[model samples]
Target: MNFDDQPHRRLNQLTGEWVLVSPHRTKRPWQGQEEESDRATLPKYDPACYLCPGNERAGGAVNDQYDGVFVFTNDFSALLPESPDSQPVADGLFVAEPEPGLCRVICYSPRHDLNMARLGTERVAAVVDAWCREYEELGVREDIGYVQIFENRGSVMGCSNPHPHGQIWATGATPMYPASEDARQAVHLREQGSCLLCRYMEQELASSERLIFENDSFVVVVPFWAIWPFETMVLPKVHMTSISEMEGKQRLDLADALVRLGIRYDNLFQTSFPYSMGIHQRPTDGGNYPHWHWHMHFYPPLLRSRSVKKFMVGFEMMAMPQRDLTAEAAAARLRELSETHYLESL
Candidate 1:
């Protein structure tokens, strides 16, 4: 089949979802000259940064001298332990439920200058361990049903601080997005007698076109139906429904994959890449999710350079998500990037 001649193809998996892949588009790489001048360097430590050691936070609480990974309640939490009882308000057209959850921040490193790429595998592994511990602790809460660990990097991603860190939100109910995926996977597993994501991972491995990197226990690839330009997913080669279930070796491999992929992202434009990344796993509400697969999704906005970003406007907001570049092409570009950051070796 001449992929270039085809307008678009909707590849359907065992699950009823479809991804629109337009292979004919020629997404010419943008060369924005202004990005060269806009590159900024972050300091190793900032005296005023709240996340740093000995700095006073918003409520007069001070950060301790945390040398490695640090976990703390968010200074300005979106959700608190003592939220007022749920008050459901219903009108003819309006309805709402009180949203309740706990928000915490995990500092990836003490050094403000260090991003994920420069954090090294050992330190990244430490962060992974912290995540596992947090997940275990939060998941046991009788009220909590879901735990979300996510990172928003770079100023373009609206991150107020340059410190390498991520946020965790443990909620009382499963989110709509993950709930949909869970329902789909459950249906597929009941019908096919196999895990949905495990089968998808096998298919991706066999296709090889979208694969970027692989370790003993993980595979980093651009999904065939990616919406963002540099969107990628990291899947565990071995089927595990949640982070808590991962073996020590698999956990370490996850750390390595994250570090390597993050370094590649930074090297892509010779700038700190802006991205929203998070892990997707089975709900903590406790049901046999043998069919569910754990994975990570990275959505970066930078399309041409550090300054230029892809906007989800017009057709995307009204119609559906669209991308200028094909997933295969983007995968190839990411595959070609070096895992080692250029700045780190210097």
Candidate 2:
């Protein structure tokens, strides 16, 4: 039976969740909502932008005149580092505990116009190095259980500023999705005596059906059970526990993969593609997790054209996530896009 022609559900091995896919739905008419394109000609540096060098932020803190990548504590952090050690026990259903953590913002570049796609490979490597440093430092802290590095690109993805930047949130508690992924990976290692992602990556590489792009050290593929329309995962060929484990050459190769993929994404829709990208790795709790295999996830909302987007409503909120595009079709779309940026091509 051809899975692409029929309505079916696919299981996510890492998170143990099912996603409903209906390939025929893509042929239906689009009478739903459409979003305005946020793409525009941006200046190299915005004087009023808080992330620009030597500018005053919204929280009244002035940024230093730094070059290249700049790191600083978030002006308005979500988690307070000075949270008191206290727990309130409830009668039966309610229980709470104080979470002590810290947040940081990393300015990818002083230039306000460049996203990862236009940011040359050399500068992208610098960002990768900064991620390794932040992960290593935060992982050693006694209070931080998980260090999450993520970026929300475009206004639709909740990015308030257009500056090329990302955030690192070190928290005392592991987030829900990562917690589920960690559990499933550990179970796979114990039961099958192999890493979960490593095995999954092998199958993807063998077929190349869902494979989009690859470098010497990393491979990007639309996972078979993707919930988002253009969701993809960057899996390292070699099994490593965390971002810190990447070797010198591996770091550069990973940076290449990122730039190429970003360019393809923007070129595919001929606009600034929006996505919520994040890296998941071993927890910072100093536990022996040989089962942990680090990977990066990209969840882009654009389903069809630049104006149309996939919203999670109705069935997704009440039951489970659903998608009209199959993984193979999404990969084929991405795979055919040029690695060069569209503006350069024109």
Candidate 3:
């Protein structure tokens, strides 16, 4: 049975979850009824934009005019540092506990029109440095257990602000995804006596069918169990548990990998791509996790075109996650795109 012409379920080794891939369903045609996000022209600096440098935020806090990158605490943080400890002592069905943590925003660039793809390699490296600093700072905290660094680009991804930025949510407890990964990685280490991601990276490198791009330090590939059409994972070449472990040269290589993938993404649909990007790493729970290997995931919702996007509904909401494209097909499409930014051609 050829997987390209059949429907099959793929297992995600990290989370031990399964995804349905219907490669034959790609033959279906769309009615062009999907929602299209605005691709309007943006200025280098918008005086009214709150995230722009020197602009006053909604909470009456003014941003500094510093260059390069900036970091600030979220005015409306979902998690707080001073959450009171409270939990039900009884082992009941509706038990609850206090979730204490911190949230901060990292402005990738001062230019409002620029995203990571167009930020240039140097500026992207600066952004990477800021990420490393924030991760280390938060990881050393006594109250923080996991630091989630993620970015939701474009308005379609629920990003209210147009400025290029990402948020960090440091929690006092390990979240569901990371917790699942930890348990699976621990189990794999016990059985195979090796890091799970490290071994998986080796396998992907040997196969090279689903790989999109790679650098001296990082490799980008569409995961075997990818649910989104163009979902990609960036894995470090070496075994490292978190961004804090990256050295000077590895950080620059990561920036290079990100820029190449971002450019390919924009060139694919000939528009500013919309996606949710995040980093997955070991929990900062003060425990040694030799099994963990840090990685980044980019889950782009676009399916066939710039206007059309893959939506998670019906079965995905109530049952299992599904997708129409195969990881190899998606990787091939991305790999064929030029690394040079499309706008740079003009």
On lDDT, the leading prediction is 2
CA lDDT of each candidate? 0.84, 0.91, 0.91
TM-score of 3: 0.96
**lDDT tens readout by residue for model 2, 1-346:** 5777899999999888999999988888978765544456799989989999999999999998978999999989999875465666776887766778999999999999989999988999999999999999988989999999999998899999989999999999888888999999999999999999999999999999999988899999999999999899999999999999999999999899999999989987788889999999999887888999999999999987776889999999999999999999999999998887887844
lDDT, model 1: 0.84
Worst 10 residues of 1 by lDDT: 10-19
Clashes of each: 0, 0, 0
Alpha-carbon error at 332 in model 2, in Å?
Answer: 0.1
lDDT of 1 by residue, 170-196 (tens): 888888778877888899899999988
Quality of model 3 by C-alpha lDDT: 0.91
Ranking by TM-score: 2, 3, 1
Candidate 3 stretches greater than 4 Å from native? 30-39, 84-91
TM for every model, in the order presented, reads: 0.93, 0.96, 0.96
